[model samples]
Target: MAQPHIAKVLVVGSVNGHLADFFAKVKKLDARYGPFSILLVVGNLFANSDDHAEEVISLLKNEITVSVMTYAVVGDRPLPRRVRERASLKSGEICNNLVILSGQGVLQTSEGVKIAYLGGRYISQCLAETSNSSIENSANAAEPTDRVAVDPENSVSVDKGNSTAGNNEEKGTAGSEISKEEKGSAASESINEGKDDTISDSPPDDDESTHAHFDKLAVADLISQVAAENEKTFQKAIAQPSIDILLTFDWPYGAAATSPHTASDLSPPSTQFASNKISHLCAAIMPRYHFAAGEESFYERQPWKYSDRISIGRGSSAVPHFTRFIGLGAVNASRNEKQRWFYAMNVNPLRNISQGTSAPNELPANCTTNPLFRFGKIARVLDTKSLPRVLSAIDSSGGGNEASLSNRGGQGKRPPPPLNYICHGCNQPGHWISDCPVKGQNKRQRSDSSPPSGYVCHKCKKQGHWRSDCPADSSTSSGHASDALSKCWFCLANPDVDQNLMAAIGEEAYVAMAKGALVAGGSAKDGFHGHFSPIPGGGHVLIVPIVHTDSLRRACEGSDNAGADQRLSAEIDRWTEAVSALFAEYDCAPLIFETSRCLPHVHTTLQMIPIPNAKAESVKPALEDLCKADGLALAADYPPAQHDGYFALRDPASGNDLFLHMPKGSKSFNLELGRKLAARILGVPAREHWRQCVVSEDKEAAERDRFIAAFSKHDFTR
Candidate 1:
């Protein structure tokens, strides 16, 4: 058997012209973790002053010997004129072992690591400049040096921009040049030849800039370049190319939103300087690892999974992609506390790695939703299906109007829809009928102001109108209550309920095994498989109210009979107490939580998960920290006289109660907040989403049985 080959790579933060110290640290790291195949330097390579110009000149002239092949990108400062001139002349290589990839494109190393790099700060003016027809015509007239061509042997060819081109055998560089189809250049020129222009006489320089700011055309070109390379490499229009690493100078906007830390913790200056252009680029090129600098503090965001799009009936495989964004502190910068400036990892190229079945633990527990998904540009760029809808929406607003177009751009709020346009489906003014939230509902039911044919009043249980139209006494019927129990999966009365998951039945409430349990089944001696639960069957249980109500509080409040309300609330409390006692028997502590919403048709269930006794102390602080980071206010008291939704948690071991009030119409509140918090505290973050933790039906039945056996003695209902 042969051992698998792994490529070792090292990435460091801004060098800031500390060449001597940086090289010394690299040599030590190389000896310890490397003999690394390559070294990637992000952010500022040299200081703004002329103090280090001599050192840069010496290194560029081959006087300095670097232990590894070095590649650097332009950062916050302009590159030295001498070094830039030498690198451009030598096709991006400054010396024997050092190279400067100053342009925006992908570079594939000898070890097959595909790195996508975008250098410099963002210039907002570039958007306006690129939109100018005269400047665009002039740019089109200039000899295009950045055209991407396909190579038969290499599959793709790059230009002076150092795109996804093959390696140059003569220069020992990563990219090679290709012959221009004079026809291709002529076609582009012909399209813009007769355009009205103010500056058509002066053509823009064709040379790549070493300036501290990048042009918007370069960003668009990079996106198109990456897309073209994917088409060439995979031979499919929608195939996602695997980019191992992405290097950028500044952090992407909203990078700290989903991270465990807040923007203030990761340097507010850096956060303020973040760019949405970078965010758009990151979304387009979903790299495995994204490294950035310019921030003086080190911060590592939780890994985020890319939104998976359905395949377009093409033969392309749907592979899940994830990106881990790491912001490194400046090298040798003075700080109150020591921060990490270097990162090293061993990786196998995506081509070398198998694209087969992945293990259950493949995704990290701390993985989160992509922060860049909020940007609409990402949807327009990556999702071709949405293009028609977007274009139609824009066209309907006005005839080629820039103001109407701006409404659909980025994250900016749009003006209210015209009063003349109303959605017949929901009787709303903001959206078209086809885009209505209730579009799937029967048209007769919406327009007739009457319930459906089989409708029964939940309040009166009479066949006719809904609970809202019920003629029952106002005092007896709660205005907010609705009957959804007949269709609810958690309701025992539902014929479709999974009986195999039911553990115990009571007069007011019932106990059942949680579907997609966060914890795995095993004994403590078996070791932690992903969760901290020591009890068998993962110790995940759910207590559900037998009545159809949005929440337990609503069930109690809406009941006309006081006795029935008290009994329902007490029965739920007893079930929770019983489960806590059962977990105590196994030396585990119970973490019980519930989300009570005022919304109609919401089935409320209390989730009870067991954690190790040792970890119980850390749960409250972790939850509080996450809430604070997410800008959620946790109050010591429950919601006061509010019909809105609120989250409640009980920590019996710590004797603490916490509540987060979710006001009505607050779309920002995350419904999965509790599950995410529990997953993090229990060390099963990957299983936060119930869909990911679902097991087979047979396995679910077995877990239910095991839990019932363990809770037999503690079953108060029996």
Candidate 2:
């Protein structure tokens, strides 16, 4: 139960085939620093060819006696053949005490320090060759280029056969940050130069150049990947911004070129291709210690504070966060050389806050829900006096001057809860109508409703009814300010998610056929819903809470210690467990997925899919590869008690679950990640798109009916 000790991590810039020299440096460090916990290699981790492979292999095999764990981001060059040949299929160990952190993902050391990595190299090649390039061009002035003496023996060319190797890599990545003129020219240039290459170079007619657009798209994808896996990290970076250590291959473009090895004098053009992608990303993920391995000489900049729009005045300054950029240089190539560029970082888990002596990293001592450090502390704590500007913009009472939310019934009267049953009007089982007691209501309500003959309701006609007398209740009658909440897509009473699609409805949750299911449809003769070819596949189901809410993260977080919220919590747990049980009954491997944009009115949805065993095994790796390309960290492990804001599912094979925590309700999030992954595994990538699989209305009805027939018996609500 002792408090965990700080981890000493060594951050090495580039090891351009300096195997012998690197080992010598390690030995010196062992003798000097004694025992570093981790050696994080950032840039060129391997020699391109076998020129230095034998020596490096020998060192890895025979001389690495220290227990220092090693990890690396992929460099511009492909991994050395020897290492790749012996590497685990994905993120497996390459040698003793060394595991190549494959693709973008997160892992926790036994010390309990969480390490989230987005492994990628800089795509801006031109920025490396000319100080006058786009990034440097934007700088005010550079004056310390000559202070660090260059070493001829330390040339990185030893690994790639040329000192200009940094500017020559683009095999699998789009080169970004070229001069604007070059970008424009590339867009209009004859893209057919590489006509024979696997990817076409033809530029789209849009103003952006083809290659430039590709870089932008690529960087956007990377940001999206990060958002996908660590949405809370992105938001936290914006709110209560603080990251202990951040590792990237290149510094943000506007950062002072502090490295004496980089040229100080240069004139740059007005624009560059996506030059601000990294800068914008950094601004959001405000790191306390930002380390980059792009330059050849070490440079350290005093921490610079950045003030964002959400910045609050703290201790005399309006600053939200600050970042200290440290640029590391390559180690020596020869046997006995050392360089100042290598960094020895000391990270104490409790440096910023209170830490007790008796607590381990897993269970930090002196812990309370210390409101001070939680993300979004600044935004949440703002008093009304400080928020006039923000509040003025929100329509607090009515849109179109409808009744107030708190007084929907006028004069401070709370509106009745939207009918809990399908319909409150005629007391129908599956549908809600204003006059449910009307003649022939029971059997008529069982089917989809259509407005009465010759009647055209002017208001709320979208539901196929006349406006004034439409089935739309007063809650959704446009005059009600709570219309949005009442008409929430997941609310059972909403016209959009009627009981027609639900087979099993429970107090807190419901079971419905997935809109874009992944599991293939089969014959009902098997005691399950048969195939719906028009809909692509059929076994997908959605286990959702009956009420409108954000994500599982929000649902659980907002639940209070008060007994009133316990049912909400219980309902969530019941639905989750029931999802697993349902999947088990069908002999299917349950792979669930969801992402929320944090909109309270938006209900959280979990997709439960069953895939073939072979396909199921491929899901994680496939996702990891995509995340790697985008430089996003996907976490797969967590300690149960600490699992907050995370979605987790245990793999039956390993008996261990994978957990990923991110912000929810992002409009950009694809809710169909499960379908997409299944598509990859099932060899139907085209159908992976959510919109592509919609079938005709009749077919959909048939699919839904079949699902209801299969699942109605399992309805726990009854």
Candidate 3:
């Protein structure tokens, strides 16, 4: 296969009104990373003062030469009058090669890279205005004012109308610089300012052409437009839309904390300015590369993974996808010569990549799980109505409906199943009755009174009888027993199982250290002082039943021999108790939870995390809070009588066992809910997902050895 064509691109930080210097640097960068396809500016393109007004006018009039196609988004500073006027034109093309992307929309480059951008800082007024506007009005609301421009004088007011006065006043001192005494006095005044900051939501004056914030409804409308375009191009609803790049002026919430780099790299005030709205948008879009530039520092986060599988009910594809986030620094504003003002890279558009090949071959060891996974469902809900055709198609196929379970049990009418609903003949969701995979084979078998030429029984490994009809052994065929034992990650018989992480082996169950333990292996200071002095190798482990069962309920009820079933349950319970006792020895209590799904070929495992004794009282309330936030009902019942799937939590500190029963055929129950709740309670929210806490294989082996040594005395099976 031929290699995909790579587009060389440059992403720069704030220009800060130094147009001449910015262009000079770009020229040099082009020489080095040569003949770049395009340039993206994320921060303030123009300075607040009029020092570079001439350059701005020159660029607007196409007098200055711009070698590569350049696009800039609105930043914190107000745009100059001339530049704003030029950008307000229909095309938003300020010069021959330079363009200002004034509003929230998707920009597909000549190279086929789709860039979804929402420029400008978020303001509450934009959302309020959007709520009152009609869909048609919202779609047409992408104006020059949509870019957030903060006035230096009235920093509190986010309304674009308020900036007009400041813009007129700044024109008077255009060519002058602030005196040292005045600068010091201004700094002192700002430091002593009160905390009663207020934003104005008054309607803008007719002459006020500049706006300070992008409308939330405009972003939703943009997504709807993209979905419509995709349907026309591909003739199907894609569950996870592919965006090559996403550009925003403000950083997404938790971007710094979830990254491998410390949040300390960014100033405290900058980190506090991160936007939750941006986070939700990023989650919904799942962009391959996200770039932001509001902070004073430059930090490139390690790549993070997000699920790319098509949601075709059960047995979906297992392809992996990853995203990289880079935050650049201000241009010509170097501190100790360490901050990176620009970044260059080669990128291949998602559409150009071959079908079977992964765009990104492998994830780095430091890669983290999707940080925005928690907000994905909520984001999708916010724009469901706007995407009528796209979402309707998804609902028909049972793909993207996170609330399908709720809809089914409610008084509302259930949605009609897709035309290509699960094939009864093949027991799969891939095709309809007329196009079943085994239709031809069944006809040939009947005529010849024997199995078809390509027939192969999966259960008995014979030529006769379909795999589903094979009478070799009912137990062996049920629950996908043979397939589960061979391919399951938790089954010890699988060659891929990480034996190095296995801490202990029992007759009916086994215990292994979690691949990525929530807690670090060291003394816990800061709040956990006396309660948990030292955490031994994260103190996180998984207790798994040796039998390959989908759920504990199945293991308990699906067996012919009641005695054997009871023993299996008892052995798993014993392992949990032993792990709890071991953690208690180190002044820690265990929070064990299990997500038992009624799906085939699943190996159930109970995850245990040791929390500091001092923080034990807060665990129950935290779990309850998560349940409420996620719209889950918490029941006081310990073991549910129904054989349906459920999420059960055991809080040893409160002596309370709570369960959240999932409706049958529900695919929206978050399997990582337990880990997320635990991370919040432990005050380490970044490690909610195991991928964020993954370490080296050597480290895993060492931790396993330490856990085994400590667990030896409590080894009940031995």
Most lDDT-accurate candidate: 1
Mind giving the per-residue lDDT tens digits that candidate 3 earns over 414-516?
A: 3444866865454456554344556533421333444567566655666776654567644436655666567788875464566546666665777888876
lDDT of 2 by residue, 506-590 (tens): 4456666765454546643353332222122365777777566566554554555334246666765666566556555555566
TM-score of each: 0.47, 0.34, 0.47
Off by over 4 Å in 3: 1-5, 125-211, 232-242, 261-270, 308-319, 336-338, 354-366, 378-718
> lDDT value for candidate 2?
0.44
lDDT of 1 by residue, 1-718 (tens): 4332345667877877766556766777666544666788887777665555556655654555676767788886567666665556656666555667786877777555678888887765233324222100011111111221111112221221221122232122234431133212322322124231211111145453333677555565565556555444433444444567889886886576435443225432336457756766776667778888856456777677754441112224434556788777676664323356766675555533333221111445556656655332333223334332332221222233322223332122434468788554444467644344554344212345666565555456666654445577342334423334445676544545665466676657777788778886687675455664567667888888766656666555555667877888888888888988988877778888888766556688889988777778887788789888768878887678656688888865567888888865444566677788778876777777675666655466557657766886787533
Clashes of each: 2, 18, 2
- Write down the RMSD of all candidates, one decimal each: 20.8, 26.9, 19.6
Candidate rank order under lDDT: 1, 3, 2
Ranking by TM-score: 1, 3, 2
TM-score of candidate 3 versus the correct structure, residues matched by position: 0.47
